[model samples]
Target: MNTPPSPPGAERTDGSSVRIGVLAPLTRPGWAEAGRHLLAGLELAVGEVNGAGGIGGRPLQLLVRDTAADPRKAAAAVDELAGLGVAALAGEYHSVVARAAATRADALGLPFLCSSAVLDALTEQPTRWVARLSPPQSRGWQLYADFLLGAGHRRIAVAAQPSVYWASGARILRDHLAPRGGTVIDLDMGALTPTAVCDELVDRRATALLLLVGHPEPAVSIVQSVRRDQRLTESLIGAPAGQPEFAEWATSLGDDGAAIPFLRYLPERLSPLGARVGAALRERLPEAPSFVAFEGYDTITVLADVLRSHGPDRALTADSWPHVAVEGTRGRIQFSRTPGISVWQWAEAPVQVVDRDPAAPDRFRILHAG
Candidate 1:
């Protein structure tokens, strides 16, 4: 809940700091830790950039606000940051918050770069000032469907939390796999006990279980319950992307988390630059870096590139973003106007399916990549 103080508008005495506003859910019920990790990544990138002489010899300063995962709060945060006269805007994890921030940024004509919010509708319009670095939820779901079908999973059982994000992801999964002759069984985790859910899945002869829970505790509970039932040993259990992308989700599940597949931005093999960044991140945070952190890092890195190429002018910053194509930790950070996606989005963001090792839960092995 402690928001960073806003930086002085581009008119500071030194006139050598480029201020960028970061809007995230730092104290929201379900988004606190994720937001913290995101901030860590952003700070790391800022440190790296500053060490390299910054953009056009101007140090990048981040002025952050807590959205608390609320749409109205996100919009207000954008307005406040704009009032501070930031050169550009970035950082948001929740889709709903991102949508609100995106709308406000477009209206204000501020360049806003979204990180890790997967809602398809975020990019379904022609908002010239808004761009996203993450692929849409539909693409992620399609990847999940492809993985399931390739693994010979036909009878699929889905257990989803009642959050709007989870519900939308579950719907996308069902819509994608059902048309391919896969038998989809939907269960609301909020209305059913884990034991009962497992029993039904077992009784229905489900070959795969897709968990769409976004938070850590519930996701761990369901995974533990499913793991306890010996009948599901051969069944493929997937956490999709959002649930298991957090370090807490895997750590909370502990050894039982092994072999449960999930989507991630980092590949099993890291690029040379990625290895250095990963080491830097591990040294700073108590836990290993999650995909969200990588996303935050990439967001700032790309933003810096934009500022460097177009200078620190706010108007030029907004104009140069659509043409940005810089390489980051994950892959090339490029924004193209795609139909039904954000006006300028990195539609081909690389994602991979990975599972924790049974012997070492912290370590993971890649199952698929695209």
Candidate 2:
């Protein structure tokens, strides 16, 4: 929606190119860094697909729209893309933006293969039109909860911003942690400054502080305050939304960013295919690729396979989720109906609780895996 609307009846494929619409947060308030890496992987895959004879010799094309983390922008982009007659849709990083795009794509009967958004309630009801490649937020956050308990963190505080995604993550942490003698508290980032957050941690005697807030502004500020506060020296800090996964976090905070654990969708060891993709992504990106970039590559890989199998028919592409058995950059990709998740889900995407090493800020240390 941040971009201009496509011309009326814009260039639908006619044995020329097989187009797929891509929705990514590429501008302000959209985590543009992640978007850059995601697009790198997606474009890389598209080139590779074209190299290997794309969709009966038609090149795969991407009509990318920038959502900028806005739901309305995403909805508009979905309408515009559907109007352009794309064979399928792919790629979105933010859960809320992807949710909006999914709702519109479903009503219009367009097949969407979501890349990186992990919210559990992607749709209000089960629908075949949408399928996701990321692990659900509940599943990933619960694994984080287990990691906390295993590390002897009982009193945890979450610095949360006002958003459905952050709220869902905090709820998942609470629901999973409370029965096992753990307590969760929320510090409103809207009302509290970074120094105030440090004071609250000291006053509440919290053993761990989880950032459910946005990055570089409040997240970076909060980490600086907490790390500097001598009163809470023993307290652990975490970011379950994976803010620490990017290079910007390290650039802004340096060694202060180390040891702040977060959820990442990657295995302990890369498979042969994964290693090859990682090397290619590092060449394409300014920094080593995060799991998000792998997610982007895998998204296009699965879509290209599906398109090759089903051949550009929209309804048939939507129906093909359950039958997809392609190998992804992380693992084998497939979709199934998960209880309460109203879309086809990749139930086996790997997740790890990892952090930067204090000694080497550029390196990641995997603490736990699930």
Per lDDT, the best of the predicted structures is: 2
Task: For candidate 2, write residues 231-299 as lDDT tens digits.
Answer: 988999999999999999999999999999999999889999999999999999899999989999999
Q: How accurate is candidate 2 locally (lDDT)?
A: 0.92
TM-score of each: 0.91, 0.97
What local lDDT score does residue 230 receive in model 2, on the 0 to 100 scale?
91
lDDT per residue for candidate 1 within 1-370, as digits (tens), equals: 3465443442353556888889877884638778877887888998899899998887898888888888888888888888877888888988878988988888888988888787887633677788888888888777878888988998988887776677788778778888898878888777888888889898899988888765665767788888889888887788886555567666677777788888777665667777788888888788888888888899899999888888767778777766788888877777787777755789768888778878877777788878
Clash-forming residue pairs, model 2:
none
Candidate 2: count the clashes: 0
Runs of candidate 2 exceeding 4 Å displacement: 4-15
Q: What is the C-alpha lDDT of each candidate?
A: 0.80, 0.92
